[model samples]
Target: MLPADTESESYRFYKSLNEDILLKPNEFNEWDMQFENGDVVNVTGYESLQNAICIAIMTRFKELKNPLYADFGCRIHELIKANKSRMVEYKIELFITEVLTNMRRVKKINWIKVTDNPNNEFFKYLVEFSVTSIYDKIVEGEVNL
Candidate 1:
């Protein structure tokens, strides 16, 4: 049996892609994803995508053109203006852009796809998207609203 070498090319490749701290909701948080303890778990590229999707879906951006500007929970019912689906799609693109602006891993948003869910009454829409890649690796995420 051969002992693994951390200096090996394969090991280094994996380390570069995987050696990152995973962030989580800590015991105490006020806003802006605050954590006094700075708690983190396993490192994962997919987790970043998942979190970004969640944040985008959960919040309504004050400025759709700007990043990191949002308020919790969009009033979808009342805010439905002319062209409901288009409005939702636009908002999602902006929200995803906002979240991924600071994320170093994801290069660009490939696309933001919004679809109708006829069966689900509570969530009439489903959002699907991909933020391209992190170090040549792809990650996908989704939201239902």
Candidate 2:
């Protein structure tokens, strides 16, 4: 082992969890990850980082079905069915920060912004943000709340 903090922060942080279980958000909803074929998908690099970001933000804190993921989720679910307002926007931003700020793949959160869409009052929140990944690559992601 290298002594005294010789490893790069990205490598050190993402040493163990550099990839996530293949769960395509676009294809599946609510963690129901499945493919047409009975084959498992394994991914790494930026794609894994992207999936991790989405999973963290979409999950309700302590709401995961898996006990191992008891602590892997965002607290924004508390705002579900909440009235749209500035305070809600702020809280959304805060919650996103709290969740993504600590991810092993995230180097730094560039910015987080919440916008309202007047079309769907019940469930229409667009949360957008940018982050520097552990590989020193800037990746942009968004989550709908």
- TM-scores of all candidate predictions against the true structure: 0.47, 0.73
Per-residue lDDT of 1-145 in model 2, one digit per residue for the tens?
2122225463455544365456764522345454535555544556568778888888778887787777888888899878888899899999899988879778899988888883465557888889888668888877666
lDDT of 1 by residue, 1-145 (tens): 2223457553456443333333343333212442335443333345545665465445554536455454433433344453556666666556556665555556677767767653565335666777755665566766555
Q: Which regions of candidate 1 are displaced past 4 Å?
A: 1-43, 56-85, 118-123
Q: After aligning candidate 1 to the native by TM-score, how far in Å is the CA of 129 from where it should be?
A: 0.6
Give me the candidate number with maximum lDDT. Answer: 2
Candidate 1 residue pairs in clash (backbone atoms < 3 Å): none
Model 2 TM-score on a 0 to 1 scale: 0.73
Give the Cα lDDT of each candidate. 0.52, 0.73
Q: Where does candidate 2 clash, by residue pair?
A: none
Tell me how many residue pairs clash in candidate 1. 0
